[model samples]
Target: MTTPRTEHLVLPGVLTAEQAAETVAGIRAVQREDGAIPWFRGHHLDPWDHTEAAMALDAAGEHQAAAQAYAWLARHQNEDGSWYAAYHDGDFRRPTDLSRESNFCAYVAVGVWHHYLATGDDAFLDRMWPVVFAAIEFALRLQQPGGQIGWKREADGTPVADALLTGSSSVHHALRCALAIAAEREEPQPDWELAAGALAHAIHRHPERFLDKDRYSMDWYYPVLGGAITGAAATARIERRWEEFVVPGLGVRCVLPNPWVTGGESCELALTLWAMGESDRALEILQSIAHLRAPGGMYWTGYVFEAVGDSRRAVWPEEQTTWTAGSLLLAVAALGGDEATTAVFGGDRLPQGLPPECCTR
Candidate 1:
């Protein structure tokens, strides 16, 4: 029997009520007592993937666990409001990668807002507001004049001026969520509003501002997934590369000219399709990745669908990442009409910051 909290997570061909509960439990099991959610028990934790897992907990109505994940982020946040790109799961103080990524920092706002919407906990929102504010500020400080955000700052705090399309698009979505949080607090941030508009303008009009990574599926769809592209443009963009990235019965390819299909990318594409109002197609995409589902309700990171001599398709990485399962839960939540997941991904109620003049002309 599906508990009310997880009832909405059930999706035909994707997840049953019991399976959904087990998946939620699997994520919970990976979360440390201090609230860090690593990719798996022995894996490193990145802020972006950690937050993605936390958001999945919220989608499953594991509100306290999600809140604890945010609390962990607050406790570990650098004085400058950014987190290291990766941390050793066994020790938060031991960062495995010291680069501070703008998109990684910005994603906290999205997760925070989603938790608030899911639980309606005013105190949690109040507590996390400063965290979100500082994070967005840190991210915006890396924004280029052309509106695309620099991808990261080196360990020595040197900013990398070259931007990535996927990272900036994700930041655009984060900015809008940050703005929504501000609106809820009755705090107006005109600067963030302006930054968001400029960022979206760059995403929609200035692909040249970003480094070329077109072979990756993320670069192909993140503008739409991040809510920076919509309507006919979004539909057209997805169609343009549908055959290139999507592997009909397996999942989405992680990159071009590779036979690997990743659960995370496939689920994110499903969410993107769901956000575009193609719920049936989204469901089909979710259903297609059933092979990636692992025992105990977790999901494999990806599969190498093209076989080598004497071998069939295999789970390439031999790991089940929390974020992969998290993405699946989120996609299922959105498709199953979970209000908070729908609201966050649908973008209908989120504030669209002031449009830059470039966008108008």
Candidate 2:
């Protein structure tokens, strides 16, 4: 089903070489010649999801295309060192959402570090250093008193004071990756180091500092997915909400009691499970999402099944998405021990925070 060039991309028996090739092709098909990958052919592109798709390309050995994706970010970045929350149809001339989300801005660091890890290209990292620095500077500016960063800044420059737990957790992970990049280049960002420490503290000791979105599945799994929680604690966190968020042989629910299982959230949970050393469980989770796969190696955003009353379950959202495919590839790559994927998700390889020696939060 795939040419010989794609055979090397296989992840043992987990994914047939053909499947991997088709998935890569599917992602590449949605990416523009200029390197911007949209959620779908006509859907909006957000910074965080765009980077996720780029990382998937790198995992597939499409290094030049991945670099081009980063180039697109470098070209369209605002003077304030951030991209808007969403660009309509991935067009620089048509940004649909003007909000600058902290998590969205910080995610570029993760993608840059991941690319460097995959390619070992010093020049690429060099070119990206200023971009990462500016983005982190912008993100840290929104860090509140309790180490929880504010959610976003409005289009008109008004700061949203409320912090989101899931977004903060993701930003926490990005900070660590940014620190690693700084360390590699001998750039001493003492402020970032200090801020990262405080952020981790907030995530670990003061979850109450963030806005409560406990109803969403992201609040249940993102800390572990973000590398802020690990070992016994991470396992416990997954266990605490597994029944509420996960549906056996189907996938993970986007939110409870909604009967909606989403491809992105399900794949992310699979990656998190792999990071926790539960490979069997992780594989099972990935396998359960097979129904979400479409013919072109694309995946639907989500599916709603018997959500209310006795209505039969059916796929919701008519379009397939780039980020959905991206998340699946990343999870599969990690399970297959792809060097960059494992390094990025495995918290052990990065600089961890030093918790308070003595004192309750």
Candidate 3:
């Protein structure tokens, strides 16, 4: 039985449950109609963020609303099985970009899988399978010979080598869901397992095959966060980069030597720490950042990145962000022993196509 002790949500030296809940409340207050949640009220909604927000809501037990969020995505999916990057709130009509992002499309699987686990609604899963199926097909187009996927598709269908380590890590997740959907339907999808394994291997063994943009925090931690890299290597990567980026009691910085720590990245770090079974440390990271929460359940995107006694400066606009809160809820669910986190953190290994690197002791 889980106790209601403050530490249940707090990370030892980090946040208390009351503080975490306050930030969560900030997130909940920003949900828009059409089931889209934005970074702030009056802000534009993006597909990746919307799916992430939906996952948080589902984990928080707001299943019905979360399902409606998925329904919104289904209704809006392009014939090619993609969604534009952004949409205006008041209109919710005009698309900001018609280009198809493979990484963006891949997130559908995560959202759908989370919703399914939360509710056990097979009917919902059946309705969503086609959407997931189409999206996976879209992701396959970006799969490269080295197994890391191309980043995005222009309207003209030109594929570029923007293959991000973080993006490919996400596709690894999408492939798992595609295979799960296939299994549920009793259909054969031997190819997905193969593709997933190959991609994971390229990421695990041959990091140079992809672009070397390690400056971004996502690149540093996502292999672990998205479950692509694991065990000692993952721990090593985090340890090696710890002082380079993490700001101690402040949260995670968006870039090296940048005097700012963003809530979204901080929450994501907490998630990664939780993934590594260091739940206490993960909770500590989350707790440290809870002070950023604003009224109405949202957070200012970042804080000043300065040493003790240095004057703080240039914080990003104070906004109640959907993804920021969503990431936190996902982390909380993970710490709370949610099964979805277990499956994700366990690396979703399939008996069929797990690469040699993944199976290594």
Candidate 4:
């Protein structure tokens, strides 16, 4: 496939076509030859964010680069189907975080499914099936009876008993993608289907199964963002927490009572808005964060703002990151009407797996 030109990418109100191209170039620039994309140069790579950056490359029409990034995951993945919480840039052997996070391992399915949608490359999908399957299998091993997956495993491979709402909800999304891959390959995985249903049920009906993290923006929105909660429920959830996590005329706060507006979270929220068919609101949210855009087409990780009385605010923490740019590109792609982006993020294009009753038959 020919590499996509930036002019064709949808940038909405916040980015010019040229700026969009720069963002693609910026993500490509940070990628290692081994196909790994880290947070930035000299930074470590985590599975989830690395997958996010790779998806941005695919959205930008860098198909080979995106495939390469996934190859890195396949090459470096632990035998247990997990990657450590962090891997030093370009050095898979040097793990910086010993923990094996379920959400991190689970995210590969989302990335793999998105890549297949973008390219329609059956061979690529077949080649990556083992990787996706292993990752999901490992992740599901952490799932509790109540449907919440454990947050992570200790370095010694013991599952952490606690679950986080954000992580479990995200895993529910990943499990859906994993099942889609299996179906396309004519591979029946009843266990995966049930696991997905259970996870969704846990996310929707049993928030108590996961630890309370109401103060964090991800915990508030992830159930909706991950597709476990939809329709009126999704709308109510966003509205209920709007005042807590969102900063009008600015962006989203990572945590309540914190002055930080994070680019990654804001962009994901924009996608969630788009998925709910609120393009106008999504575009506005994206526009509000234009201040995070860098000259090089990368976006700052986030800007910390403090209100010093009189409603005055100041922004700081100046640094562009690959994942931030990736997320922005993904959100813009959905707005731009990229079929794959719309399918995976906007439309219910990816399967959400079957509920328990269907699984029995």
lDDT of 4 at 99: 96
TM-score of candidate 2 on Cα atoms, chains taken together: 0.95
Tens digit per residue, CA lDDT, model 2, 1-361? 6454454445543467888888889999989988899898788999999999999999888899999999999998898889999998899999999999999999999999999999999999999999999998889999998888999999998999789989988998898899899989998777887777777778777888999888889888998888877778889899988999999988999986788999999999998999999989988988898899888788988989665676667888878999998998989888877888899998778876544445432
Locate the minimum summed-lDDT window of 10 residues in model 3: 1-10
Error of 1 at 52 (Å): 0.7
Model 4 lDDT, residue 228, Cα? 88
Winner on TM-score (3 vs 4): 4
- Per-candidate alpha-carbon RMSD to the true structure: 1.1, 2.0, 3.5, 2.9
* Native-to-model Cα distance after best TM-score fit, residue 85 in candidate 4, in Å: 0.7
lDDT of each: 0.93, 0.87, 0.75, 0.86
Identify the candidate with maximal TM-score.
1
In terms of lDDT, the poorest run of 10 residues in model 2 is: 352-361
Ranking 2 against 4 by TM-score, winner: 2
- Which residues of candidate 4, in runs, are more than 4 Å off? 1-4, 307-316, 356-361
Point out the higher-scoring one by lDDT: 1 or 4.
1
Question: TM-scores, in order shown?
Answer: 0.98, 0.95, 0.89, 0.94
Report, for all candidates in order, the number of backbone clashes. Answer: 0, 1, 7, 0
Score candidate 3 by lDDT. Answer: 0.75
User: Model 4's lDDT to the true fold?
Assistant: 0.86
Greater-TM-score candidate between 1 and 3: 1
* Top-scoring candidate (lDDT): 1
